[model samples]
Target: MLDWMNRYRRNRMVDHYITQLGPALRKRYGLREQYTVPQIQKTLVAIHLNTHYLAYAVALYRHEASRNTVNLRLSQTFLDSLRAEMAKRYFHGRDSYRAHDVLGLVKTSRWRGGRSADGVRSWVAGAAD
Candidate 1:
């Protein structure tokens, strides 16, 4: 994974952060000078640490199945951590990104939040991404 990450990092353009990043990233996401490589790398590393913590938690959760009392409890923390990482990396730690913060996995707000969906779909209709 490290080998692949290094290769991808070196190949991707680092200059003119937004323009070289291509239209897929889109300007409307509010990408700025603050969203540089070093900043993003640090966030990714933090996410890595959270993932390790979750993994250990899952292992402990499995072990607690036979015990009457479970020492580990993080159902909420796990979800909150996951959400925080996503916000930090993608939305640049913003509370809200654009018109509507509705997140769609398969389609971009198309089937979800109707008002935001129609709004976003019409807005990005011309872009290649």
Candidate 2:
């Protein structure tokens, strides 16, 4: 019960923050009613984390928008802000491997294909070396 409540609370907070980001984003992009706050939030989160499914969804959603518009809206500063917020909320104080630590191994790995999904997996596996 306690765990469930905590999860629910966290979810609610996420939703709230996403909702708050909506207006700022819409205003930034000068988008009228085409995209809702929830949609924008989901897309931003997807792009920030480089999530496969969500990234696809966001791509589909942006099919109507110009590439320049999409690029400008999903700027690095915005993505980094969202990433930092998410890290603070979910991964604060958590021990994790930094990307640089594995970059050398990944770069040196002999994957069959270059930077494909399977290649990335192989790189990750070989990154232990």
lDDT of every model, 2 decimals = 0.33, 0.42
Clash totals, every prediction: 0, 0
Summarize candidate 2's per-residue lDDT along 40-107 as a digit string, tens digits: 54646744532322322222223234444355475434444444544455456221322221121223
- Stretches of candidate 1 off by over 4 Å are 2-74, 95-100, 104-129
Candidate 1 lDDT for residue 103: 20
Task: Mark the 10 consecutive residues where model 1 has the least summed lDDT.
Answer: 60-69
* lDDT (10s digit) by residue, model 1, range 61-86: 12112221123343445534544544
Q: Estimate each model's TM-score.
A: 0.23, 0.23
* Top TM-score hit: 2
Which 10 consecutive positions of candidate 2 have the poorest summed lDDT? 97-106
Query: Quick one: best lDDT, which candidate?
Result: 2
